[model samples]
Target: MDMSRLIETPLHRLAHGRTGDKGNRINISVIAYRAEFFPVIREQVTAERVAELFSHRRPTKVERYELPRLGALNFVIDDVLEGGVNDALNLDGHGKTNAFLVLSIPVWVPETILQLREEITA
Candidate 1:
């Protein structure tokens, strides 16, 4: 509960994501850069949160599949493409932007994790 113990950062700082799509469904895979960060990413990033992030797309469903060994979380978002690339009115209907959108999600990390970096470089 101590505010000083936490730091907010974009998810991209702890992980990377890739976007894919098929028949109006969007798939995003988020992988943590370090094993130590996996648990935090898994705990903070949820399907419900992801659906909220892409609410403008009005996704019909959102599913999150976890791969702990790989330190990754894969999200399958349905009906987000507006009817697929060939049919969606949006110019970038491929859903390529979804990955970056998800990555921009703010993540709260323990200040200790941030301190690790400073200790390494000092």
Candidate 2:
């Protein structure tokens, strides 16, 4: 398939994610719903971009770990919890919903992949 042309697509349409928290840190896992979408996600979802996405929280640092075999990406975001569940006044101390924020980032996908995803979802 020709991959020269790509279309803007929401990451949620290509993958699903879950979040976990530890002290002042949150770890989010983005797993492609289909193996075919993994490449598109991996290429566009950068550590810098993830950091930028959570810029409001002023994360100390953002680290991305690639699990190609599992068709997933793990992001460890530090210092976004406002000082952990025990200390933070925030309702989302655990930050379980942060995964959705990460999944909200848009990425460019080849038309072939987009069509394939649409077919599967439909």
Off by over 4 Å in 2: none
Global CA lDDT of candidate 2, please? 0.90
lDDT of 1 by residue, 1-122 (tens): 32458899899788889999888898999998778778789999999999999898799999999999999999999999988988988878898987989999999998877555454346
Judging by TM-score against the true structure, name the best candidate: 2
Give the alpha carbon lDDT tens digit for every residue of 6-122 in model 2: 899889999999999989999999999889999889989999999999998899999999999999999999999887877888888788888999999999988887777876778
Local error of candidate 2 at residue 78 (angstroms): 0.8
Candidate 1 residues lying further than 4 Å off, grouped into runs, are 1-4, 116-122
**Per-residue error at 109 for model 1, in Å?**
0.2
Quote the positional error of residue 53 for candidate 1 in Å.
0.7
- TM-score, prediction 1: 0.89
User: CA lDDT of each candidate?
Assistant: 0.87, 0.90
